[model samples]
Target: MTGWLPVAPCTPDGCARHTGAVRAPLPAALLLLSGCALVLLGVACIPLVRLLGAGPRRRLTRCWARAVPQAFGVRVIVRPHLPDGAPDGVELVVANHISWLDIPLVASVLPGRMVAKREIRCWPLLGPLAARGGTLFIDRDRLRALPAAVRDIATTLRSGSRVVVFPEGSTWCGRGGGVFRPAVFQAAIDAGATVRPVRITYRTDPHGSGLAAGAVAFVGADPLAASLWRVVRAAGLTAHVDVLAPIPADGEDGRRALARRARAAVLGPGDLLQARQTAVASDRANRPAESVHH
Candidate 1:
């Protein structure tokens, strides 16, 4: 659990365990059956949702979003704090990236269009589904494409729709994440929207104990299939989504300042403490191995 580990093949006896972890992987059959059922249900409802208008489509999308995580045995807990006089117009939601699960976890509470990497737009069934759910894809590798992506996001916001963006640009271990990229904040500035910072942290307990659990992060070089399998097998996994007070992106406020404030809100005092604890634990665990090597 100190670092990323390879997933063991499933067997009748059960998947192999991390040497010092307390939980055992759940059976593969259970995950497969639940996954299949969820997929079939989603496919059957696609046509129905498509027939509806935008408002109804978004509502149904929220229902399905909530259902998908439950199918994987993960619960989404939302803590929304909105100050009085908060703007009711288009809202731009910015959050930390922890795992692929962050999508459904956030969607379950706040339904909106997502800004995702262009690669996700071609990922088999998921790609098509995401497009139908109103995801805006951006080619993060191409610097030239930034203006267009920003324009699209601004347009979506101007149309009275919510848009979610992970400014970190990539997933990371749940303990902490990379710096927030300020480019996406330009969209909020351009649209004169309200930016709401959301903090997403995973836990192994229903009541989060302020610890960021590693079991829920999709980090390192793990394949999608392996991460999905691990998620399905994990028990008592919970996602904590904290929606901080909204910040207005007036014309006067620079995008850099907006990005800094948003990032600080997401990585608040509580998160910093949890990160420190995780670093200390990791250091202690590595000491024995270092001594043996020496």
Candidate 2:
């Protein structure tokens, strides 16, 4: 079941030679099935929203995400060490980027509006769900447009919904957290929202048996279908979700300074209290459940 199923590999420019037709029909079918299931679930959620309201609906959304991981033959292992305090008005959460799949992956774990690249807004079925879920899309090439978008994000946070952003700006292969983009971090500072740092890692096991840290990683230009096939061909995957410390919405730190600290906290070593005094402790005033994790 395990062997180096090699293609000619990619050139330095990241283009694969495609010398051999890498058959991915099995993985493709699995992905297509998952997408269909998600679409049905989205439609089913319409009525549920009427019955349960936004609170329960969002909760259900997260629940659906959690269930899909295993149903899709994925596993999630979360180790959260969040900083203490409540964000003053809104919250801006920053996290590492890994794959396109991270969308549903994080969506299942956190109930919030996602900040995605603008192209995602045009995606087939996923686009509609993201838009309905209040996702904010940014066109990276358009710097002029970012200011207004940031303001909009600030407003959304002030209205009391968490906004999720991947500060890395781009996805990478492996467990590595790529270079952090500093622009969007300003929303957290501008809105005085707590900036929570999150790191996500995926461990793949070809044999479908292993611990969290022991699994293989699927990274870098590995097509989704191919990656899934590689994983299915392997054992199983144990995904590690680490919620690092949050930085305060209030501090003497400038935007770049704050971004640096946050990037370090999520990417580098551990520091628990830096996030506590600024955000988490203050948040206890908003929701008692803020302190509790599922």
Candidate 3:
């Protein structure tokens, strides 16, 4: 990452811990193939999927999303803790970034428009799928283009569309995650939408061990192929998505404040404490270097 782009501290060698049992090479290969086949199948059904009504399309998309991860031998569990009676409007779903798989995990429950980098619109099969799914792309190369992009997102929200964004910007290795970028929250504020913070956590011991499955994170320079293989072979891998209660964007707070509000909601108490501890440890480790430089 360069310039104003966010960079995660997670690196492949340092953070991708391959925890849990291993799958045989043949079975893992088969699982990867099955996942690819599902992708192709989804691509083939694009037209039919587009023709369906919004509600039905979302339902079908949710099922297909769930199936994709299952094909990759990963189980996804959704804890839907929506408030009893939250007013319905445009919803801005913000989630922490973990891996490419986070996309499908989020789509499974909240099938909505995803915000992605502009380059993703040109990829192979996945590119077309995202375009068909009504993705909002951001041109990261041009800071000047952000206002226009924000306006476009606000317009989409005003149309009663749900916009999903990984506010962390870059993928983290599921430890002490990065802070949420505040720019996107402006869209929610402008559109008077409710900001919903969804937390995505990876666990290697799916027997409810709750271990961090950072092994599957596509952080730093890890190639996409390597991440795919790791995910396929990682036995007992499970993804937990906790959909926290929504925070109304109607408050007169600025985007930064809203970002903090949403991020706090996503991290919850446990993660917030972990993050603080991680920061403290990191500071202590760097203290020697700081003294040398001084």
- Tell me each candidate's TM-score: 0.78, 0.70, 0.89
**Whole-model Cα lDDT per candidate?**
0.66, 0.55, 0.77
Please say which candidate is ahead in TM-score: 1 or 3.
Answer: 3
What's the CA error at residue 205 for candidate 1, in Å?
0.6
* lDDT score for residue 279 of model 1: 41
Ranking by TM-score: 3, 1, 2
Give the alpha carbon lDDT tens digit for every residue of 1-294 in model 1: 211111112221222121222334545447645865775676567778889877677666767877787777777777873332233348888888767778876776667788887778776556667766668877655556667878888999999989988876556566544455666688889998899888988777768664444565665455667666667666677788887888999857688788778877999976666644544434344322110000
Q: After superposing candidate 1 on the true structure, give the runs of residues whose Cα lies further than 4 Å from its correct spot.
A: 1-28, 81-89, 210-212, 272-294
User: After superposing candidate 2, which stretches have Cα over 4 Å from the reference?
Assistant: 1-35, 43-51, 81-89, 205-234, 270-294
lDDT score of residue 122 within candidate 3: 81
* Pick by lDDT: 1 or 2, better one: 1
- Candidate 1 has a TM-score of 0.78
Range of the 10 consecutive residues with the lowest summed lDDT in candidate 1: 285-294
Which structure among the candidates has the greatest lDDT? 3
Q: Which of 1 and 3 is ahead in lDDT?
A: 3
* Global CA lDDT computed for model 2: 0.55
